[model samples]
Target: MKIALIAHDKKKQDIVNFTIAYTEILKQHTLFATGTTGKRISDATGLEIHRFQSGPLGGDQQIGARIADNEMDLVIFFRDPLTAQPHEPDISALMRLSDVYQIPLVTNLGGAEVMIRALDAGFFDWRKLQD
Candidate 1:
């Protein structure tokens, strides 16, 4: 499965820790992430992630395109809702694209954990039918 990862500045650490804890499961699939989040996750978990530009610089749109094209099976976006983002439109687009495509998106640590667990359990294999 192809998994897209994104994290707001404040939630980067949470995403890193979550990735680290689930590294074994995640290592079994392809991973993609936005610039800084990808670098931070790679540093902490030693996972190979295809990195795009920073979110504010179009990384969110890049991932959104993948989602729209049905290239991505799941998205884990750890957003800091309490903070304002300069790239709010990009974030909104990503979220909207996920909904439009019917892809599973986890916007918080709790939901991300559930989705990762489901991935580990092979629940996402059926998604291959959509391709």
Candidate 2:
């Protein structure tokens, strides 16, 4: 499965820790992430991730494109809801695309944990049928 990992500034550490804990399960699949988040995760977990521009610079849109093209299966985005984001529109569009394409999107640590566990348990194998 192709998984996109994204996180806001304040949530970066949370995502990094999540990836570290799930490195074994995550390394089995293709990983994609926004610039800084990718660097952080790769550094902490030693996982190979395809990196795009920073979210404010269009990374969210890039991943959204993959979702629109049916090239991405899941999204694990750690959003910082308490903070104001300069790229709110891009973020909203990315999320809307995930919904429009019926992709599995996880927005917080709790949800991400459950989704990653499900991924490990083959609950998402049905996504292969869509290919």
lDDT by residue (tens digit), candidate 2, 50-129? 99999999999999999999999899999999999999999999999998999989999999999989889988675767
lDDT of 2: 0.96
Q: Could you tell me how far off, in angstroms, the CA of residue 39 lies in candidate 1 after the best superposition? A: 0.3
Ten consecutive residues with minimal summed lDDT in candidate 2? Answer: 122-131
Q: Which stretches of model 1 miss by more than 4 angstroms? A: 126-131
Every model: Cα RMSD to truth: 1.5, 1.4
Model 1 TM-score?
0.95
TM-score of model 2 vs. true structure:
0.96
lDDT of 1: 0.93
Question: Candidate 1: lDDT of 85?
Answer: 98
